[model samples]
Target: MTGNQASAGHLLRLIRTGEATTRGELQEATGLSRSTVGHRLDQLFRAEWLRDRAGISTGGRPSTRLEFDAAHAVVLAAALETRHARLAVFDLAGTVLAERTEPLLLEDGPDKVLVRLAEWFGPLLAEAGTAPGKVCGIGLSVPGPVDWEAGQVVQPPIMPGWDRYPVRRRMREAYAEHVGPVSSDPLPVLLDNDANLMAYAEQRAGFRDCGAFLLVKVSTGIGAGVVVGGEIYRGIDGGAGDIGHIRLPDRTDALCKCGSFGCLAAVASGRALAGQLSALGIPAASGSGVREHLAAGRPEAVRLAREAGRRVGEVLATVVTLLNPGVLMIAGDLAGAPFLTGVRELLYQRAMPRTTANLQVVTSSLGERAGLTGAAAMVVEHLYAPDRADARLAALESVSREPHLSPGPR
Candidate 1:
């Protein structure tokens, strides 16, 4: 490989991913000379991004195994729902240092919610004993489709004022306002759909070997996330898995938030069931409220949720036929046994036998924290990948060369 291509960051990525743990293995994998490999390893070691551990003896001398030091950096993550938000400070390895969930209505608009998130970050960082400079990047999970390239939400149904919002810039400004100016640079902010992040996290943690993974989130709105070959399949312009807007033939009168009639979400979403319950003298309003009712074993809520699940399952029948996912996961507030059973009743019955032969229908194992976990993982992976990692390393090295300035705060 060329010198510009085989950088210290590239070598570190190899070690971080377990692709090559020893110098000899790195040399073999990269086709670099031993001296070139040694130079790269030294740079990584000096940056504290890599450490060495004793390795098993093979022949002449035992090789030292290189390992990624996850504690070298931290990530800030937030998952914003329609009615509430969850925020956390995580290490590079996706371990939560400090986290909290609080009520913050999305309809309040981007400025207010983002400022609140910034306010929360201060205490969270202090509580975790993480300094501002230690934060490598930030990740935000929202309940809408994201223009990943633009770092903005695009035409969200529930989030009225957030269409094409400058989420990343506002978040960076709020963060600076709350935490004071960062030394090295403003932290990179990344955004994605909540269901997409949840599905990505679940598949990586449990079903990494599965070539195709699908997850349906049955919350205030219904959305699906699909992962194929370990990568999220965001269709052209990030609108691939918007199964909630799929129209149902029989529910012609149901009106969705997106101004469409007969949309699946209008009939089968948590919001729909809550409205049905409210009409029947119940006080349900949000998806969380529906979850509470379900937990209490309310007969009407249970029945309605199951019916919703069946509707979702009917739609998923086509998805299964098209994607042929090996693992179909049910997540969000309505991911309980009754709902899953109803889904199975429709999905297995309607889908082709060949599709269902090896499909495994399951519930979310990460529960409510899946989005947060996935957000952190996304940030870590993005910031530390080979190409990006080299730039970051160069920035760090340049800062180090200036003897007057130490490596930013943490």
Candidate 2:
């Protein structure tokens, strides 16, 4: 292999993914001599990024197995809902060390939400018994469309006054203040749409081999997340899955948060169902209120949830035909049996037979943890990518406290 191809970062990736375990496997895979492989591996060991353990004997001699050291760093993840937030500290191996949920309304605006999230992160790390300096990066799941490269929220209907908000900058500064930053490297903050992260997490956890997977979130609002070939299909501007805004012919009189009428979310979201319930003297102000009523087996909420599901399913039929996804997962507050039943009714009735044949309609298995897990996983991927991993390893040797702006995940 050439000098660039035979870089230590490349070799670490192979070992980390288990493509090359033994020294012989590394030599065979990279076409480098045993001495050359050893030289590159030495750098990883000094950085405490790689470790070894005994391997099973294939024939006569047992081999040493190389592994990525998960304990070398930690990740901070926050899943921001329309009216709440869930945060956690996770190891690189995706294990949750500490977690908590709090009330954080989008109406409070971005500054308060981002700063409070950062401040709360300090205590969570303390509870996890992890040092502040161990944090490598943070991942945020916001309930809106996000420009990944720009690190800002796009024009979001529900999230008022948050258009093009500098979330990344604010979060980083808040971290330095609240978390007592001391690392030579600047901690990175990655942001993405909430539904997108949930889908990414679910696809990787349960349907990894599925070629195409789609998740539709039916909470306060409706949104869809698409995963193709194990990656989030976040179109050109991160506006790919805005199915909630698809205009419905009969809903022309319904006002939507996007300052438009006839949008699907105006008719079929949990908020919409809650509004219907409230009109009949049933108290339901938010998706959570609707969820509580549904959990209590309230007949009124169930009936409305089913109808909402039918309307959402109407839109999903067209989506299924276009994407031909292998698995369709319905998630969020309104993904109950009544809702799912209604969705299946319309989806199967309207969609082509071929689209439904291989499709497995299901609900969220990870439940509320999906977004938090996805956020942590996103951070891990960004930090350990070949090029970033090389820069990190180099930073470990040299004491430079310069902030780094990483390119968004593709």
Candidate 3:
């Protein structure tokens, strides 16, 4: 119906977002002719990226409603906590198909942990029944500040020997080695801070309407993730939410992992609580251990966790006044009822009335899976968005064009 061609990615995006679900609607949205829409739709159909079903009629025959085929590609997601890691294989729509929990320590450094992740990919892919070539991308969540563009961590206090490491490149190579060679070429990898990813997933899943959101993770270390206007607010160099290192007036002698004294994390983080608990004859060694102690209703652990929450809440009081986030989420190992109660006590008491008026202090709904889900969603959005989707489509088409070449699982 028109001389110029419409982009397949544009048409696919329209359908994927439910903006234009029918051929007529797509033609109208893009100002393309029906035939142009048909041609573009054909590309997506051939790639198994979209499917169509009958839609309700307005006045005439029912139109076909196009929908994104989530099964078209899969994403591998990993969340590297301080003491353990969680890995999952997810479809394009963020549905986890396969998952595993492993006690991989981040203190082992990036090389060993990332290599272990590579080793796990083969079995994970097999379990998910996803071919190596079908993997669109991989997403990793690490407990550190990430230079997102460089795909590397920067001066992470807890992640030893990982500063400025080439995580994406090394992880890609490891994947290729473990899963096969094909995974090396087209499979993109992305990395971000764990709290950032967790906040991203939680906000998208539960508070999509909230323009400003905040998530504080109180595990072995402490960190905050901020989302403003539906996007992560990574500062100029990804150091925006390092609230854990905020110097506290009362804790001037407390030593922090960043070799700083008086940081809030040094006084009130889960690691701090664990140390205090151990001194009290409890066996708490890490954040997870503190969680276990709290689960068993250990009085010392609960008391320390509540105190930690109060300290974090004091900082959040200032944060609430400044950012006025609609949702202030408390997450990580120390996000239980006692901690939440303590946070509420200080936050509500210290923050201005106007700030607390609209604020909703909530706990994590996604639990340990938040980071993985966020990682998956991050990969899906990055790879399938309008600006990037066309190039990906072109690459896919090029591979398809080469009939003799077999795609390997890199």
| Clashes (N, CA, C under 3 Å) per candidate | 0, 0, 5
**Superposition error at 231 for model 1 (Å):** 1.3
Using all chains and alpha carbons, the TM-scores for the candidates as numbered come to 0.96, 0.95, 0.95
Note the Cα lDDT for every prediction shown: 0.90, 0.89, 0.87
lDDT, model 3, position 148 = 93
- Tens digits of lDDT, candidate 3, 1-410: 13243488877777887988988888888888778778878877776788888899999988889899898778999999888889999988889899999988888988999999999988999999988767878999998899998889999999999999989888888888888755436458999999999999999999999999999999989999999988889999899889999999988899999999999989888899889999999988888899999999999888888888899889989988999999999999999988998899999899999899999999999999999998998888887786687776676677778999653331
**Runs in model 1 with CA error above 4 Å?**
1-5, 57-61
Clashing pairs in 1: none
Cα deviation at 313, candidate 1, in Å, is 0.5
Tens-digit lDDT string for candidate 1 (1-410): 55557788788878987999998888888889999999888888777888789998978778888898889888899999998999999988889999999899999999999999999998999999988767778899999999998999999999989999899889889998898666347679999999999999999999999999999999999998999998888898899899999999998999999999999999989999899999999999988899999999999999998898899999999999999999999999999987898899999999999999999999999999999999999888888788887787788888889999887732
Instruction: Give the candidate order by descending lDDT.
Output: 1, 2, 3
Best by TM-score, which number? Answer: 1
lDDT of 2 by residue, 257-328 (tens): 999999999999988988999999999998889999999999999999998889989999999999999999
